[model samples]
Target: MAGKLNILFITADQWRGECLSALGHEMVKTPHLDALAADGVLFKRHYANAVPCGPSRASLHTGMYLQNHRSGTNGTPLDARHTNWAKEAAKLGYDPVLFGYTDTSQDPREEDPESPWLLTYEGPLPGIRPVAMMGTWPTPWTDWLKANGYEVPADIRYAYGERAPGPEYEDGAAVPRPLIYPKEADDTSFLTDRVIDYIAESDKPFIAHLSILRPHPPFVAAEPFNAMYDPEAVPGFKRKTTHDEEAAQHPWLEHQLGRKLFRAPAVEKKLRRMKAVYYGLMSEVDEALGKVFAFLKESGRWDDTLIVFTSDHGEQMGDHWLLGKCGYFDASYRIPLIVRDPRKEADTARGTEIDLFTENVDIMPTMLDLIGAEIPVQCDGASLRPFLEGRAPATWRREAHWEYDFRDPADDSAEKRLNLTLHQCTMNIIRDEKFKYVHFTKLPPLLFDLEKDPDEFTNVANDPAYLPVVLDYAQRLLSWRMNHDEQTLTHISLTEDGPVTRRAARY
Candidate 1:
């Protein structure tokens, strides 16, 4: 409290909360995060608003539920008319900064004056400047290598195992193990080095978000970690074969690309190796992050800094026979979240974990609350500070929410659309302490009693006995949409000075 506070926001691309040792995953070691948790608070049941980068981040940075600001996928651009945290932070005299890219794409309607989604697509929210907007993850790695005098391959990506002499698929190497220091330097290490350097010189009340890429595909790790775990050592996904088998129910996963791409044939052995490498990559991130935290502690800035650790979303790994996150399942939507308040409270619940439902969408509001900034009235998430400090608002929803838009027909031909047009096969999920409801727009809905089907092996949505349960969830889902939709259903008036103007419903 002696100086202007610093906010260290660390976000990984697709990290699973269960992957951390602190969370009971014995495979990975996150000592620094563990240490921070010792002095901070960890949320055991946090989820993501959406999966696969863009949409998820849109919700995170904007503090809005997916329904309110629907950028539903990676290619969809968020509408810029809304407000974002960094923009508001700037008004508070703090120079909010971003270290990595915000996958938020430009709304096509705005980009192309004639695009259909234009009236439909939301644009970027205002505020926050990316101090370092390395176009994509590759740009950051390449830049770091060059700056450090390391020669990086222009062909930045390579597959782990060769698939004969074909066009190189971005899938990573076949070998999975512990972290191996590169002949020069690893991307994970390099990015962290840059982050450490930036924090060292930063004198402002910095709000830095370090977005890491790893354990994502390209499952390659530096070394040592490259060959870390034995397949058997890493737990097998609870439902693999059944998952892909079920994919037939969903069009996107059944498409040619989805089918052909992955470590398939259920290579249990290879998967273990892949997971080992994934863990190795994770450790590398942990090591890099530890340095940043250590520096803060050593510089005596630790007390004034608030650090939050979470991922944009969770990866499916081999869960439900899927690779990466693109579904409405737990592996794809559930993420990890830890908030380390710099005050370092006494009775400081070190390694303290809360099971209350939480999600990345709540992140911005939490940060705003800590900085004493005004959270926009339109925000959907409640501040996490209350839960982190062991307080839960009575109004908090017992169930966490997540959404998925079926693929746009033009791009990949999915069935979630009304008639297979530009829209996607949409699925909405509402997860509570024990039950989960996954409602696909036109497809068979899925329901699970998490208490019994923790792995989600049983789909009860079709069971007659569970019809009532399904109805309850469906109603909730509908209510959620009605409360948060763009208000496209009704005609309202907007006043310029006195009142405004009125418009009729177009759609």
Candidate 2:
């Protein structure tokens, strides 16, 4: 509480909120993250505000909702005027460093038409310095792999899928094999090494973002981790018996299921195998993080550091007959959140599980708050400092909110398929203790009674009995949006004398 606190912000890609062993997950064992939660406070109902990587991170880094940020898709550019946590921290004299990618799409207004950064959405956040950046290309990791005498692939994207020398089938069935690279040379390990090296050499208090890409795509794990969990032992999918039955839920669900990319494999054994590999990848990441946590304690930085462990978004993992992060389901938005404030004031809250609704937008304000930086007026979320100090805020949100835009500007695929305009290819969700309402721009709305049908297998919006509940939630969602619209200059007024301005209250 006295000196500048070191910040270690860690994000694992495509991690489900319920997969942690600390939360009683049946199969996945994330011992290192569970230990971090023991020293931190874990929010049970935390959610990402948007889907995929870029849009979710835009909300995460800027503390603004997707509606305010307007970065709806992966390739959508983030507005240049927004002030992010990195920029706010930089103002307070802390050099924010990134060990991996932020998945930021640079605002086109700030770049030339031919600029290479404009070509991809996987750009770095504006204020952070990249120590070892990993993205779609992952040049740094690939270069390291090549330098270490490993046979690099002709196409770098295939690096992670490269399997060890072995038969492709076992007992007349296809199985996931370990990667050709050893565990020490894996991408997760490389990023962890960079973070450890940076912390070892830094002389002053540091702010480092360690973004680990795992439990994501190319789901194969290395060596021992590949066999860590038995495929049959993993929990079964939470979905209807057949894809056709699941797709009947809604028009959007039907559209998503029709696409091969989003649909789960038709083969049941393959789907189970993929789920097992995903858990294996999670275990590998957990082990890598164990090293970082150990190094922090050994280097005497553990007590002085504030660590936040989370994910950009959640993975569907064959849930509801889907394989990727998209749509309006909780499986795509609800993610893990664990905040470990090193100050003595936070000790009382350690190991506590908060059931409150927290979103990815809260991350920016929380980091800024811990560092004593000004939370920008553009931020739509409140700081979690009060919770960290063992007290709940007077007014806390009871519901979680998220938005998804299915529009494809390049090909107009969603527009053409859904028979709607680009703007109509979007949906917003408001979910609380008992009910969830999904409002689409043009499609039919979906309302689920979470208590009666927690799996969201049925929609009750059309039922006369639930019509009032839908109306109430719709009004609440509208009010929530109206209240959070961009406020950067809304607090300032032009006067005859001089400008009079008031700071925006986060809550």
Candidate 3:
């Protein structure tokens, strides 16, 4: 509303929406993010439209659903034809820098089939300039460590956790120990330092996407962070007492609960320890981010920067006997979103909390709208510019919709085990304030009364008393799908004068 604003988009991988201290979480403390919310507006009900980094970031970057983008799995490539925020920002003469991994699978059609990029899902997104890129291997950070006299492990994952010297568990899940690296050398710290250094060198209005991987796997924290919380004092999990109890609820849950990698720790104490470490990791990230906030303010860029903080998706962290982000659970999809616009016009809405059902797709459009850039017609999300300007849109969504395409194209392990076709391995969820409805491609549907059972321990889909609610939600899901189906070419037509395009003129 005043000057050309610099965009700082930060994402924390696998961070749950409820973990923010500003949002009144009991255990975790995020003082920096709390300060951010105090200076900005927070969307309390933002959800990711897809899961497992690749599919979710595909929607986040392209502003399209999994159905429209078709990048269903981690190794799946995003179609090259689609336009992304990075490409659009590049059109406006910005480099659109990326400080961390985007989890984008390279489009095979544009490269050699044997190209190294095709081998992993950690490839950089199409148009962004990589100021620094850290992935599962994290060559950049590892190299930095090596240069600084730190021993680099062949498998970088070992640096995150230690396995006990004793015999492993029956399921082969090793005991997770605290990180071997120092607090300053942690991944979150390294990335934040890199971003601060990059911002220092830039004089132009820039768009930087910082993707942080913390409070995510390995369940390890460094130094005081590892000792920040007591495992015994951690909040209790909102899951069934045992895995079998969860599995008995649905066929999908049974299959999901059987996966060793996603299963919660068998020992209750060990599970609570994992949760304590997770909260510590979150606290570490918050501390690391505090440096960024300090840098922005010290450099006098705070007033001209639009800061956005959110996660790609959320982790279950023992919720429903699950550890990773997947299935139809709210813990897997709900993510925190905070936007701080420092323009004088946005002062009225600063420190405000908007209670609207928002999704990851809305992010791209919101950025474009703020920068006065043209929003692509292909985006399924609407901009939140009105909210930042202290006005509600005439019409806003009342429900949050998310989809998880669970097909493993390489192994097809799920297909054979679950007796499902690759095409039938998907699930979609529609959740309103009061109720949530989960529909699988080829499995039994699930209905949860959020008001009565927030933990979602009970599925009331088959209850005669709730039949009307289920039917209504089912129809709403159908209507949502019909309304959001792909329309890339729908607005274009060949008229008597020539070809006419409704949205093409803006670009």
Best lDDT goes to which candidate? 2
Cα lDDT listed for each candidate: 0.69, 0.90, 0.88
Candidate 3 runs further than 4 Å off: 1-3, 162-177, 503-507
Ranking by lDDT: 2, 3, 1
User: Tens digits of per-residue lDDT for model 2 on 1-507?
Assistant: 233899999999999999899999988899999999999999999999999898899999999999999999989999999989999898888899999899999999999889999999999999999999988788899999989999988999889788887764233434567888999999999999999999999999999999998988888788788888887778989999998999889988998998989999878777887888999999999999999999999999999999999999998989899998998888888889999999999999999999999999899989888888888889999999988999989988889999998888986777877789988888999999999999998889999999999989999999999999989999989998898888889898899978999885645
When summed lDDT is taken over every stretch of 10 residues in candidate 3, the lowest stretch is: 167-176
| Better lDDT candidate (1, 2) | 2
Supply the global lDDT for candidate 3: 0.88
| Model 3 C-alpha lDDT per residue in residues 60-163, reported as the tens digit of each score | 99999888999998998899999899998777777898988999998999989789998888999999989788887787888898899988778875655643
Which residue pairs of candidate 3 clash? none
1-507, model 1: which lDDT tens digit per residue?
A: 222667888887788878887787767888877887777888889899886687888899988877778778776768777678888777788776666667776655446687533543223334656665442335666666677676555565432211223221123444443332362366566666677777788767787777677667667666556655555577767554554565554454455225545324365666666666677778777887888888888987788888898998887777666677776678888877888886544244555788778877688888888888887655677787766566556566677888887565355534432355454367788889779888866656888888988887677887899899999999987887776665432444555665443442111
In order of TM-score, best first, we have 2, 3, 1
Residue pairs in collision within model 2: none
- Cα deviation at 360, candidate 1, in Å, is 1.2
Looking at model 3, residue 144 earns an lDDT score of 92
Q: Could you tally the backbone clashes for each prediction?
A: 36, 0, 0
